[model samples]
Target: MSFDLHGRTQRLELSDQNLRAFEAVVLESTPEGIVLSKSAFYPGGGGQPADHGVLLWQGVETRIVGVRKGDDLHLIPAEGDPIPPVGTVVEAAVADERRSALMRTHSGLHVLCGVVFRDYGSLVTGGNMEPFSARMDFNLPEVPPGFKEAVEDACNAEITADRRIDVRVLPRSEAFAIPDIIRTATNLVPDDVEDVRVVDIVGLDTQADGGTHVASTKQIGRIKVAKIESKGRGFRRLRITISD
Candidate 1:
């Protein structure tokens, strides 16, 4: 399975983060999920949640609540919604506001990851995000003087710099050669996966990722380090909120 194709569906979101709507043929359909001939719906992964949207067909609207990933990408519909019949041509749209917010949040997390690693030399243990808020856990035995305030300041500064965020697909050998990919908290791409999609915050950080992101750091808006909590044994969880 290449990075842009999931089972039989051509995954459109990877190539165009800005695409909100597209027409697709229904390859398979059930009350639980619908598989499309092509889709721009981002199947959630890498700490970012899946997208929510709707499929319009024959005057019927099927609300997609989440995506179920497998051999094929299955779009989960809102319970009680009508399922499109197989072969039905439908107009699908990804909720723009929610997706746009997520793009900023995801990029903000990358900026946070890049900054923390550069300044503190800490490794991320885990992280998760919602529209404009996120929490990233790092392994830091000791919080240095003014770490929280310092981090927030640096993050905003990077935003001011307006660094470019670039995404590209590379072969596994070439991608793993980049040192930063090894430092990421999660490098779980399977051995069988030949093509790796890399997200780069120019001059900042790079990771093998498969999630949608904003085009640049400044697009992330402002990142406020809200709280820092100790999760015991050298683990620190930092909560953040994104704002315009």
Candidate 2:
């Protein structure tokens, strides 16, 4: 299959890394697997989870159980298969169900960020995501007594609004012009990259990001502010759970 550089536009397409195997002509050989002209697989970056699945080549199914990045390229398993010379094609498929769940969880966190920033002006300090749950750290002296409920209400309101989630790659200059772009946690964006992919929650939130997400907030379902913990010194942690 031809590789699409613009995979974020179609979340379903983005999940195909484990579903469809393609003939990947090797571009460069390494102890690791070869690089192809187009790869559905993601080389894992940001705080998002890595893409895990399988790689098939020359009738051998090598488990691509992990993904790592090197100089902007992905290092996958070569197993025992003879590395095809440059110009060879390989098939790749992504673990769809796992990826989809991550998409939901990632988008849910963005919604939460919007609610927290809009309501309390808190800044996100750090966060991570699993298939069904996510946690975000914020720099707040103390969560208001009713902050949890308020955040829940706001998130659901945005979900109910069915806001569209737009993903786009922008030139560095253009991206810096947007107000929300400046609010992202520093480590979330790679400073060396000249272009940045931005995720925009229409009328809700926006930030520079590389993680995959659902097309609309409505797809995130009902989100629960499961727990809040004191992180001390003007910081708090918020845990969120989403029902399948």
Candidate 3:
């Protein structure tokens, strides 16, 4: 399997430490670990967290401590073991718990965006995600009183609804047809990119994205809109946390 440019959504099902033995073609080999033709790893981008996993070569396991994207390539950690030649097969596994936490956090941010956009017609200006927390900036004059609570409640309601999260790639023209998608705070779809990957939260949210997420809102567990702050004129920040 070639490396998927479009991100994956099944976090828990991802093999964590066991993918070291699978076959993979080395696309690029450097002092850093090689980039394989097909990798389950995601190089961090668009404010989302980077993937941490293990790459197996022979009987040796090397930790993938960091991932950086180059022009059409991903730069991984340096190999401490013998470097595999190009076309060599290797196994890759993502850190399961970290990936799962990020999935929940990423999905929770989407839910928050959906609620804020629907209720206030606000657009998200920026955002960042960690393992268990994330924050989004919105182009709103000010966060309304009790807005945080309202958003939390709205997110929980959707999670309880167990809405399915769908991800797929679409042609640029096809993706641009949706008004709601075009109105996202960030221009997630790169202009140079030919195809756009979209994440749809059933009837609640839809936007162009290339981040990992859960298959259903119910997998997000309990979400708390922990804080809301004013960034500047017409911009508000919402901080969120997901708990057990």
Candidate 4:
């Protein structure tokens, strides 16, 4: 994929997500959508959903219904809307309520992963999320008795601990030197990715992650292990929900 310098979208949200809205000049305009010089909209990946918000230009505003990452980050407008022209300056805002819920829930899942690994010595095999709901799979022979209750209790305990969550970008060499503290497969990272983004639950867990997260475990509110399912041999899936 190739794009001119003007078509590049600088991702502001990656540095500070609290910056919900910002002004950026339009870099590209097509029938599909527009790309901004910089963006706060998350072109969702890593099991997290994309962000939806609004784009404001002049006195006209249109809802951003979807986002996709390609040669440039494209902010898709609602159907029948006019694409902002190149060189137009616009304001972009993410859906705060939805973003917050997703952030908290994502952090909560990490807490669950940490708790399960600490207690059962199981690594996370897979996970996915939606706003306040999430599920994680582990390489376990079976769902142990009282496992749901124990995970719920343990996750809440960590939330009470209010562990700080930190995000850091490290050189691949430096990251690989950390002795692989992640509870999931690290081989999924491409060898060419020289810089790895790491999300650390301070004292609990750390992994190469690209999703958004809350500042602390306490912000995750309460987590409930809603269900646990046995998925074939050596697999167990746990579903959870978040509430205040």
Measured by TM-score, how close is model 3 to the native structure? 0.87
lDDT of 2 at 8: 21
Task: Find the 10 residues in a row with the least total lDDT in model 3.
Answer: 8-17
lDDT (Cα, tens digit) per residue for candidate 4, span 1-244: 1111224777777778676889889988786878888888878877788899998888888789888777777888898877787899998788899999999999999999989888888888888899899999999886677878988999999999999999888887887777555577446677777777788998898888877889999999999999998878998899999999
lDDT of 1: 0.94
TM-score versus the correct structure, for each prediction: 0.98, 0.83, 0.87, 0.94
The model with the greatest TM-score is 1
Clashes of each: 0, 18, 4, 0
Backbone clash tally for model 2?
Answer: 18
Task: Kindly list the per-residue Cα lDDT of model 3 for residues 91-117, writing each as its tens digit.
Answer: 777788887788888889898888888
Candidate 3 C-alpha error for residue 95, in Å = 1.0
Q: What is the C-alpha lDDT of each candidate?
A: 0.94, 0.72, 0.75, 0.84
Which candidate order results from sorting by lDDT in descending order? 1, 4, 3, 2
TM-score order of candidates, best first? 1, 4, 3, 2
lDDT tens digits by residue: candidate 1, 1-244? 6679999899999999999999999999998889999999999988999999999999999999999999899999999999999999999999999999999999999999999999989888888999999999999999999999999999999999999999999999999999878555656788899999999999998988899999999999999999999999999999999999
Q: After superposition, how far is residue 27 of candidate 3 from its true place, in Å?
A: 2.9
User: In candidate 3, how many Å is residue 24 off?
Assistant: 0.8
Q: Residue pairs in steric clash, candidate 4?
A: none
Predicted candidate 2 versus true structure: per-residue lDDT over 1-244, tens digit per residue? 1123432212233434223344455566565644555555655555567766665566755556555565435446646644445555657677787777877888999999988988888888888888889899998887677889989999999999999999887887898888867554454565666777788999989888777888899998889999998888988899999775
